[model samples]
Target chain A: MMDYKYIEQLLERYWQCETTLEEEQILRSFFHQGDVPEHLRQYNDIFNYESEAKSEHLSEDFKQKMIDLVEEDTAVEAKTITLSQRFAPLMKAAAIVAMALTIGNVAERAMRENSASEVAGAPVIADTYTRTEDVKATIKVIDQNQSAIMAKADSVKTMDLIDEQPEIIE
Target chain B: MKEISFKNDILPLGDLLFRLALRIVGGNRPEAEDIVQDTLIRLWENKEQLADINNIQSYAMTICRNLALDHKEKFENQNISLCETDHDRADDHDSPDKALIKKQQYETAEQIINQLPEKQRTLVQLRDIEGKNYQEMADITGLTLADVKVTLFRARQTLKEKLSRLAQ
Candidate 1:
């Protein structure tokens, strides 16, 4: 004889939303039998519905397709790490250095320009024409030196860098 | 406190995930399976957290459901498999004649269920099919306890109405 008290307790927990997965499984199992009690017949349809719904299964071919997709994803993931693993540190360090150098150069130039402009204004405002000429001369020299470095670098053969890329057929 | 292995421990959750996904996507098996695959991979990646999780099935169900919803949103117009036929149970019933009649009733129920809005359908699936507790259903669907119960009540009410109509 089925335990009426246990079934009642399960029904209570079921309504209260306190049944565990195992307990829920037991309920389904009990309800699944061919011979359900007459008093509990009202719940048979609900339990049977649950049982029929739980029988939902993916087809074999669909399952295999999932496995294949998962395998492909893992393969792609492996390749991604393999490619990035070699260059990831270099990329990080290069990014850090590039950012640092760009910030430093911009700050340094801004400070120098600010100082020079201040110097130009201060001497002119102080009515010191001679000192203003000296400041102008110093700024000109710095500009000339910068241009000299640029001209030297410009004179280096562009073809030499292009050839280093190994795309030249000849 | 069980040690979880990825292939043995985690992969098995794929079936449960698929079931949840199928429910969410309204029986779109292909999309459901894809969601399960995605959920499994995520769980495998986050296996470290599984040990700390109070309910792995609920956690996995949430992942699977979310993934399936995202996919359904993305492919809103894509032709999906008519999933009601996937578990047709054509030859399993003891009496073919009764089974045929029951099949008609089952199809009618499926049609009514398929017509439900996504939230109601999923709520019904979680409540009536999966037999989830309110707390677990709330956890899986990311709904509050009251919201889960309310939605489930409305869903069951709708189904009961439809079933009654069918009876009539």
Candidate 2:
């Protein structure tokens, strides 16, 4: 006969997440035997399922198919290796864009600071009319650059659209 | 890394995954088997990650549950509705007498559980059917211990309420 106290303690520990594998096995065995007490009958289905669920087996054909899937994935990865191997040009292009942006930002800031300092140093020496004309020329240059950037952005969008509407469906 | 043999390390979990899939998918053997296969492939891909895992079974359950939910979502998306007839069809194979008895119990029980959202069903399966502890459930689900307890309490209450209806 099983010790009811010990079994009860193990059940408590089972709920509390402290039971070992052997203790869990004991619970399953106790529950599996023909005569579960009235109170524990409700748990019989659950415990039996817990025990039997572990032994649920897959078919042999399924196992072979899984191995085939693994092989297929590996083969696909191998085939894609050359594509990733050609990423150096893309990496270089990204680096070039980054460097140009950094340099342009620094140059623009330095030029602005230099002009501000010059204006401060020679407050009234330079002709105000000449400075106004120079600012107008700068505004025209900025307008031209803005239109160029917008045109470039529009072309990129059109290219994206073309790619999305693939002519040949795989 | 050396190739992990399916027969040695992972195929054993197929039966566990199958039953779990059966319970979740409700006798849709093909879909459940697909999910089991997917879970095994996922484990093989992430085998390195398993070295840190204490319980492979719990890890596999998490994968299986996620895959099963994904399949259900896809099924719903495809307009493949889960009709009451789907389960009724399963009952058709049983003898009329046994079917009557089972139908009575199944209706009362399944109605209550079927009313539960998918998350609650998954939790009940892990805790009640699979006998996973709170911590193991917490680890597998990434849910807190309190969350597992509250969900489990609600699940058991649902079962209890339905089971009591039989006495009536």
Q: Whose lDDT is greatest here?
A: 1
Instruction: For candidate 2, write residues A71-154 as lDDT tens digits.
Output: 778777644457656897898899999999999999999998898777754764467767898889877777776666567668
For candidate 2, give the docking quality class from DockQ.
Answer: incorrect
* After superposition, candidate 1 runs with Cα above 4 Å error: A1-47, A60-170, B1-3, B80-84, B88-90
Q: Evaluate every candidate with DockQ and list the scores.
A: 0.16, 0.16
Q: What is the C-alpha lDDT of each candidate?
A: 0.72, 0.68
Model 1, B50-165: lDDT tens digits are 99998888888888888888988988888456554643574485587867755665555666776787787787777667767778888988889898877766666666566555
Note the residue pairs that clash in candidate 1: none
Q: Candidate 2: list runs displaced more than 4 Å.
A: A1-31, A36-55, A71-170, B1-3, B51-55, B77-115
The docking quality of candidate 2, as DockQ, is 0.16
Give the C-alpha miss distance for residue A22 in model 1, angstroms: 11
Predicted candidate 1 versus true structure: per-residue lDDT over A1-170, tens digit per residue: 76688987886676555566678677878877747777665555555657776766756776566567666766777543576888999999999999999999999999988987887668666778777887888777777766655665589845554333222222
- When summed lDDT is taken over every stretch of 10 residues in candidate 2 chain B, the lowest stretch is B81-90
